[model samples]
Target: MASYKLYYFDGRGAAELARLVFKQAGVDFEDIRYTGEEWPQHKSEMPLGAMPVLEMDGRKICQSLAIARYLAKEFGLFGSNNMEAFLIDELFEIFAEIMNSHLVKIYYEKDEDKKAEIAETFKKDSAAKYLNLIEKRLKENTSGSGFYVGSEVTVGDLLLYNSMYGHRKWLGKFGVDVYEGRPLLEEHFKLVGALPNIKKWAEERPETAF
Candidate 1:
């Protein structure tokens, strides 16, 4: 029952991982959003001048992954042991890096041609370097439950699901589908997306161009 406020642009971006965790944990938090026009005015107030800062009991924290890790610990979503937590973080960072690779280009590149080119390369590189590795990793999880870390859903799972869901929704414009063709990833994506809390949040959460 701590006072929590999450600030982000009006979209399902970085803050969404924590938001989904909150929903899964069944916690109430203020989801403060800003628009492009309003962001600059309040930009100076954000820690690191970045959005997706999580303020808990008036203490502000920045960086999406850090906030996510903290929340995972807070909500018992980190995993049951140190080893579990390690696996969870490992999977989370891998998924985060993959998502960020394309996200930076999609958000910052001004040239449509360049962006398209980047997307093509991203699709190719991701498949070659990551998609198979992740499938093999998922196959190694003891649960064999299509989860990234353990038997129960963890923060890593949410991050993975969010990456795929967002990629499918946001990256399709560039003709890139990060979650395509990998059978285990597809099943993992489906399993996490269909979780009760996540499904509900997806149904009701604000729509964003991202």
Candidate 2:
């Protein structure tokens, strides 16, 4: 089997979607993690001065989105047509934007009061925009089928699940339970989480305290 080495921080911040995609595809790979202290020294060796680098067949790749799309294409999670791939990319960008904004406030904001305000606004805006969009997408997918993006699971579903899971964990500090009014999204989360492959992977994977 082809294998990969994924280098990232100890937490599941940026690299998690890739991790989950690999697990769902049941591809065996090496997961390399670093601490904050170790990352500075480790940074120069990476392709783009960034963590979350994925190496396959001795070739290194950078940028979480590029790495994710490559893995998804390899694992058959990408949509079948150019149009579908374009749609997949669109969804990926939406989730990425939302996640980045929340992470920035959490990591960069200096004032406690301002951080709280930012987080609350993040939860509201993200929930209102991204979650609602996902809810609509899932409802459309619900024609007696349990897949998002197509007749079967695709990269979009996995990425959305990881984002929702991360948001649920991250927003808890602000007391923003993400599932309060979004029943469709809650069901979507549960549906994706209960995938037999995903559930088993979650059980075997090393738990990272996000």
Candidate 3:
């Protein structure tokens, strides 16, 4: 087996979803965390000048979603079929949009007035636009109670786990009940969160706002 090393800051940011996938897959990898003071010295060495980078036996891959997707495929977590893989990948893409368009937008907006405006409507905007779409997808799934893609957990589920559960506090800051009015979403979150590996990892993982 090849060695894996994941480099990211010492927080449950982009890297956490990959970590959750690793936990679910029972794959062992080196988690290389960097502090704020330590990042600058190594930033120039990164493939895209950012993390979280996954190095497989020294060959590196950048971007957290890519890394997680690769690992999930290797670990039989992407899906059992090509169409399933597409569904899973598309779900993950939706989350990337939510993270970039709404979640991160609130924090990165330098103008306080704009930031306040974003916070005021963040929950409704995000729910109506993104969460509603996800809810519809959930309704399409078998029973609307199982994992997003198939009978088991997928990389997409990990991304969903991260977006809402991992960052629940941040969303809650704006009174975003991501699970509200979306019973399927709530059940899925609860089911995924209760998976043995995920539950154990969540119980023992470090506490972080995001």
Candidate 4:
């Protein structure tokens, strides 16, 4: 077995997907969480001066999605065929765009008025449009397994669940509910939550304000 060590902040943020992947794969790896006060000292040590670096067998891998993709392939969650992998990659990209372009901006917007305005726009436009598209894709691709890709769970499903989980956790204060009117998504969320390994991970993982 290869030695693995993941370094990230105490909060979930970008590292949650990788953490989930590890847990779901039944892998034993070191999860090193840093405090805000302790980050500066370790920041320069990271390959890209960022958190969520995964050190595998002494080689460090930076970037959250890159690590997640590597773990997904390692854990057999990348999908069964070329077309399935392509679709899974597409969904992951779409989720990342939504997070970086809309959700993260709204979450960190400090000015009250500006935050409210951006939140409103996100709720009305970005959230609504993209969430509906995801719901439709899930409904079309789901073969009663509640997974976004094939009959088995894939990185696409993990990405969608983590993205929505972040939205609900951070944007709820602004009264943003992305699952509204999306029953398929809501059901999918429940299904993912109920997965044996995921349920244990959720129950055991530290609670954070992410």
Candidate 5:
């Protein structure tokens, strides 16, 4: 059993998926959270000047997706085979693209009108397009068991779950509801949230604005 320490801001923003993976795998790790004021003091110590960083036995790993991939492979969440791994990677990339393009703007934009415009576009366009595709993928899987790859829950499922959870929780403040008219996606969200480990982790997790 390797020792793990995760460094991230006091919010779920990008670190939540990795946390979910750890919980699902029954792994123990030190979750080090920082506030905005505390982050600058610790930022210089991070390898990439950003988080969420995963320290394994003192070796630092930067980037959220990279950490998620490492945990996935280490804990048997990658998939059952090579093709499944590839599919999971592809799905993860797609989710990242969506987050970068639409979701992130709402957080950084200062102008109220511009932020509103971006949020609406995200809800009407990006969320609709990508989430429906994800829903179709879930429905097409062998077991239709709500896992993203093969018949088991892969890192892809965790990624999608976190993305949807963020959109609902964070974007909901802007009156953006991505699940509107998407029954499959709504059901998928509920299913992921209902998983025993994830549900327990979520219940006990610290609250943050993001």
Candidate 6:
């Protein structure tokens, strides 16, 4: 077994995908978290002066997306070929864009009322727009099979899993159920969640709030 250690803040913001991947792969690894105070001293030691670093075989890797892709490829979660992997990567990139847009207010917004306003606008415009597009893609990808991107589970599925679930909470806070109008999306979420390995991983891990 490889020596795998994932370093991050004690939240689901960036490292969740990697964690889920490791869990679903039934890999035993160390999960290390740090607080704001501890990060400054630790930051200088990191390769990129950042959190969410994954130390594989004692070699440190940086960047959440890069780490995710590396692990996906390592664990066979990435698609089988270059083109298929590229397609999975493309969808993952799209999810990253959506998360980056809304995460600004999540960590920095201080004013209660203004933050609520921002969340509401984000939900209606950015989040809704992406979900609608994803719903259409999901409907089209349903060529007698339910999975997205390919016939088998891929990195794209995990990326979409995080985005859809993350935004659902952000949307609900604004009185909008993110899945309200998207039955296909709901089914998609359920299918991802019901992946036997993923469901077992989720259940065994301590309940984590994003």
lDDT of 5 by residue, 83-170 (tens): 8898888888788887787767877999877887888887776677777777777787877677777887778878877887887787
The C-alpha TM-scores of every prediction are 0.93, 0.90, 0.91, 0.95, 0.94, 0.87
Candidate 3 segments exceeding 4 Å error: 111-116, 143-145
TM-score between model 1 and native: 0.93
| RMSD for each of the candidates | 1.6, 2.0, 1.9, 1.3, 1.4, 2.2
> Each model's C-alpha lDDT?
0.83, 0.79, 0.81, 0.85, 0.85, 0.76
Candidate 1 residue spans exceeding 4 A from truth: 99-103
Which structure is stronger by lDDT: 2 or 5?
Answer: 5
What TM-score should be assigned to candidate 3?
A: 0.91
For 1-210, candidate 2 gives per-residue lDDT tens digits of 566999998878788889888988889889999988898898898988997999888988998887888999999999777766876888887776765756576668778777678777776666577767766766665445556666777888888778778877876766767667777666767888898888887677667887
Model 1 C-alpha lDDT per residue in residues 1-210, reported as the tens digit of each score: 689999998888788888999998888999999989999899999879988999988889999888888988998998888888987777776776776765677679998878878887888766457767777778888786777877888888888788778777777887777677788788888898899988999999977876
> What does candidate 3's lDDT look like per residue over 88-188, in tens digits?
88888787777777768878888866766776676655557777778777777784447887677788788787777755666566555655677777788
Per-residue lDDT over 56-129 for candidate 4, one digit per residue giving the tens place of the 0 to 100 score = 88898899998999999998999999988988888888887887897678668789778767877887877777
Query: What TM-score, to 2 decimals, does candidate 5 have?
Result: 0.94
- Give the C-alpha miss distance for residue 163 in model 2, angstroms: 0.5
> In candidate 2, how many clashes are counted?
0
lDDT score, candidate 2:
0.79
Candidate 4, lDDT over the whole model: 0.85
Q: Which residue window of length 10 is worst by lDDT in model 6?
A: 170-179
Backbone clashes under 3 angstroms, per model: 0, 0, 0, 0, 0, 0
lDDT, candidate 6, residue 167? 66
The lowest-lDDT stretch of 10 consecutive residues in candidate 1 is 98-107
- Lowest lDDT sum, 10 consecutive residues, model 2, at 140-149
